[model samples]
Target: MKTFTVEEVAQHNKADDIWIIVDGKVFDVTKFLSEHPGGKKVLVKMAGKDATKKFKQFHNDAIMQRVGLPMQIGVIGAEKKEEAPKPVAAAAAAAAAPLTPGKLVSADEARFGDGFPYGDPNWYQDWNSPYYNESHMRLRKVIREFAEKELMPYCHEWSEAKAIPREVVKKVAQAGFLNAASGAGTNPSVASLLPYPLPAGIKHEEFDIFHEFICVDELARCGSGGLLWALQGGLSIALPPVMNFAPEPIKKKVVPECLAGEKFIALAITEPSAGSDVAGLKTSAEDKGDHFLLNGEKKWITQGAYADYYVVAARTGGAGMGGVSLLLVERAWEGVEARYMDVMGMWGSGTSYITFDDVKVPKTHLIGKLNEGFKYIMHNFNHERLGIVMQANRLARVCIEEAFTYSMKRKTFGVRLIDHPVIRNKLGHMIRQCEATHAWLENIMYQIKTLPEASQPARLGGPVALLKAQSTQTFEFCAREAAQIFGGLAYTRGGQGEKVERLYREVRAYAIPGGSEEIMLDLGIRQATKNFEKRSKI
Candidate 1:
């Protein structure tokens, strides 16, 4: 915390003893000149000078935190400053004034983070809203901080390794993130069944669906879709069927272990033959007197290779949706094998092709009734699609945030990127789409809360599906536009454009999963038509 004067910093101008000020913090880069990616000439040019403008022109906050902070020698001392202009001073005074009257929430208390404007939700900037409260704010802060400290720094590293370390996964579980992310934290019955408490010390009764939204949204802020999927994607989809419909014996054995992070699970529904056609899945489970002999091949199963168990959908009778049944299959059992698949993105998710060669699943492990798994699967889609909406929407925002930040610091044609009308137009589209999708998402969340649980599938499914498509498409548009803004830097794997590059590669992962955009668009209209007819009493 030592302060250095401008005169004092000027004394270290030599190449062997260099110092520069950035945003009032002094960094002694004497030893780092050789390691500077921009080369020694740039550092030498800024030696013993305020390089705040120059440094930001080529670097980002992540680079600052990772490389610059460590070399900090001291901060620039405060000096005499110019007085504020009359108009600016008056505007500042008015803006700082207290709420005129009847403000529901204090500006300071409702504000969530200091991120860039629109980088977070409008609620984060003290905008009035009915959906969130102090409890939700508490959970947001906790998860955001957790993601920043535990996940963001290592996202690229883990994605490259294609595996998240077990210890970090355990920490996430211990913090109650698993329960929240799984859609279980908001369900009272499911919450009672799990061992973990709601995150941020909110009791089960106080933890509403919006809190669940916050959990997924904040974690996605890490800007690594692979890491987010690897951690919770499979469990969120797989565990719910068990929690909602499995036999008592199966629930007793499987739910606790998975929630505790002692085991992992994947939803093995998509087969090579069936992408969106869940009914066409060819996996079969023949009934025996003692157990079900399972035989199938599951493709593109998230977390499949790393999972200890799988919630599998297989044919139990005839050859369509009516015949499909969900079963909880143990990975440790005989004849079960999983091998990782090389995919375009979501590498850290352990996407795999799994085979079941005469795997024995106890009859007790059957989820709900035989031939009734289709209903269970259908019921689960609302939550799954909503989760996708949460992730895709935030990831879209990450694109806006990264591109916008870069546009500020990066100059083009003798001006900042934001100063270009064409660049602003692209950013405008990204912002508009992202914000509109977010509003739609929040509305769906509100409907989920107000509508009865049993009525939700019928009432909310179509809207959720459409929202999923909207969000992923928004994510896609933002990723592409952000890449355009970053230009060559977005093509690279790391540095200032790391997040934009990674997200651009991940656009397909979001769009194709949780129902493809084409499928969702049709389904939304069809479902809405059916609902409209029913509402008219026709």
Candidate 2:
């Protein structure tokens, strides 16, 4: 690559001769100099024999090692990005018009036009996304603002302490974020598509709810996977069953309580021996006409430490899924207690082992119906998985963003490390994966929002299952890569540097939650077969 001066690179109109390829993420600095926020100083500092070392010095490791993947932020001038290489163009030659009007060029085009350096137009001081509509845009803005102000400020400290102030959760609840599908006059099941009845003109309200999800995504930027997981798990457990299965009287009592921060709920399914094997769960609820006597020990339950109510899945019949039923068990019931289960991540999520010693649950609190609890559980796993999926995607995004920023300012070997092709390729792949996963997730999310709730079936399970597997796996991969990129600092408790180190310790749990990778695959295979059979009209 021909080296150019800061001014030359900055003034690099399309006509500039020298191509300044900074740290390998690629940039067509050809015209960026004029548009840069820092003026020529930023580029000038990056000039000279090798600015890598100085660049490293200027930025933090988080940015250098974990800049976000491609296309998370809207492109400023995507038209000029250097395209990835094309396959051998054995195609008959075709001419193409260049921007210069009369200039003729070969039809072959690079996949990415030209990648710009960090701190370019497409960059955010942090993360940003351009979703489908105004509601999404507003939501993204709200989340970004919140992260910068609230979480970003205290994230490093909290990561070190492994404690998210209860105030944070309380504030989030106050923000009306927890009321996702079940707004006033909106039946809980109405959140589902297909047969679920819903009031007209509520799509916007639903869209607003998804925005709250954005708040959750941005929370990961705080750098504590465990904290994010602990907080979010409540949403996963509480929303679907309570909204769909709880009786109106129960809903009236609990929903408002949950919203008021006076109570919390969780869906209890995992047990000491039956972590992902739902069918093997030994939890049982025997009917005594007026109430059910339950006996089981549930482990690794998020919110277990504080949940005032639980959507408990129990063995109501004989064996397998058919024998199962969901019951809403209140904490006030006799013989119910939760013990803390210390963990590597999500420290304050109040994870615990919940024991039911002949716990008495009223018959009215049964979730869904007897022998039909499995379907209701199945009904919401996809949404739960997607939530996991988004977290995984966002976690990777954090890695990329932090790494990229670090790489830009950190100088090593006399230049910004990003100028190295090897580093760029490594970081580039991370970016690509995150963006691809995000795109895939957004597509599925759109479908879930618009598809009729009635049409959701066991067959639909396959897609969500596949996504759950893919999302967690993707997150784990990116986290590892980001760690490697950060080198040493990634290993230590960077204390307050948005602890990527902390994330490494927490990555394992992400794979475990919302059903382990193994369970996801098994469920995916079964659902895929069902989908295939339906497709064949079998």
The candidate scoring highest on lDDT is: 1
TM-scores of all candidate predictions against the true structure: 0.90, 0.72
Best by TM-score: 1
Estimate, for each residue in 317-386, the C-alpha lDDT of model 2 and write its tens digit.
Answer: 9999899999888888789999778777766677889999998888988877788888888777777777
lDDT of each: 0.86, 0.62
Poorly placed runs, candidate 1 (over 4 Å):
1-21, 26-51, 70-101, 104-110, 535-538
Model 1 lDDT per residue over 1-538, tens place? 7889988898999999999999999999999999997799999999989999887766666677667888998888764466873353233233223322345444554455665757998877756667866567668777887888778877776777878888888889899998898888876666657777878878888778898899999999999899888779887899899888988778878888888888899999999889999999999999998899999899999999899989999999998899999999988999999999999888689999999999989898889999999999998898898888899999999999998888887887899999999998998999999999999999988998888888998888888888989999899999999999999989988777888889988889989988999999999999999999999988
Worst 10 residues of 1 by lDDT: 91-100
Tell how far residue 407 is off in model 1, in angstroms.
1.7
